[model samples]
Target: MSVTGAVDWDQWLRRWDAQQTVYLPDRESRFDAMLDVVQALLPETLVALDLASGPGSLSQRLLRRLPKARCIAVDLDPVLLAMGRAVLGNFGRRLAWVEADLRDRAWAERLGVREVDAVLTTTALHWLEPDDVRALCTTLAQLVRPGGVVLNGDHLAFPLHLPTLQQAARTLKGRRLEERRTAPGAEDWDQWWAAIEAVPALRELCAERKRRFAWREKNDTPPPLELYEQALADAGFREVGVIWQNMDNRVLMAVR
Candidate 1:
């Protein structure tokens, strides 16, 4: 499998699907937060889109909360899509899984989704560069109907200064220490990182991708919250602000 340039969907799917058990739980909390934001934005059932919806966590949660809501879970990874189908098949007619790269405009058109009531994504958009992020926001603005919303539940902002990083590190350390003290057997961030490191296939994949991409520990780009808001505004969105925050996790909500 080719590891240079953009990630191939097939390889990504295989790696993720093999480690689904590890990933699924981590994603579940993020999806839970996303569902909360969605509920606050639109109390009633409405058509929704889940962008970069690996394994349909957000879509599945939305269906559980708003049984009448129709959701289209979009992702480029066929293996993950298959996993989503297996996990969320009980939703039957309410949920549809589509395999498509968010970077492609033609795929959106093919979905026949002129306008949706809302759009939600979690822990995925950061994979793209700033330009693609802006373009995605613009596309979403066009895709959502007036009075609709976009809830982005992920880490949208990170401090750049050393002091802030130190503070964040201290906070995270405290959280981890507390977790260990309270729940000794629970999986913490350290464990999560270790688990990923232990996965030979994932390590190999990351190593191969990093050589081509010039992997960096800290991103120099502007905070995702600011970038997203700017893009949303440029795309004709009306209201944009963070509605929820839990440490580094945030939910940025925008209205059209």
Candidate 2:
């Protein structure tokens, strides 16, 4: 369903992107790097799963870049899903929105496809516990076609033993964000959600979103990179490696 009456969907999307940039100063850089990998490795008519696809941001970019590609954008947040459906409905059959929690092992089967060419996620999945991440990786291995790839871009921490490296990376990230503190109309993550709560048309969705995620105690501290590498490898991925990284921020690729 489209957002009711006089909503500037494009403007809302722009605001969302801006808010995200406040957290990750190089957000677009990571997106571009992921797209670059997709174009180089995947077929033109790829079918991809955009797991935890908040507002369909990654799906929108992927479809725009690979015109012939199709995507199943999956997420559980009702507010974000409504916004994504409203904005991306114009893509028709090329883009499908699935409201499924990533924590559900059965989420993959809900996409109505036996296999996809690729599975891509960004700035998501960190909320899952280590066991949940392992389960999700096992599902992805089965869902993605042979020789396909899974690209996960998020802040994957260094091992606890590397305290010096971790501290340095965190300090650099803080300094960079500090430089943009004065940017006009830039909202922090909380502010963005607050704005959404005030939108009359989205009020119901916001409430539903709250209920759906009420059990989520907090975002999990991301597991070390080694866990991800090992999980994918044990799940049957032939090769797993970091294709992109800015300290703890990384795009880990796994080939099935």
Error of 2 at 137 (Å): 0.4
lDDT of 1: 0.68
* Model 2 CA deviation exceeding 4 Å by range: 1-5, 90-92
lDDT (tens digit, per residue) of candidate 1 on 46-149: 89998888877668778888877899998775435655766576486988878776766666785667989999887677767778778888888889999999
Q: Which pairs clash in model 1?
A: none
Q: Model 2, range 6-118, lDDT digits (tens) per residue?
A: 66767778888888889888888898898899899989999999999999899999999999999999999877877777778848589998989888888887889999989
Worst 10 residues of 2 by lDDT: 1-10
Please report how far candidate 1 places residue 167 from its true position, in Å.
4.8
Query: lDDT score of model 2?
Result: 0.87
Residue 86 lDDT, candidate 2, scale 0-100: 73
Q: Which stretches of candidate 1 lie over 4 Å from their true place?
A: 1-33, 40-43, 159-223
Task: Give the per-residue Cα lDDT of candidate 1 at 62.
Answer: 88
lDDT of model 1 at residue 201?
45
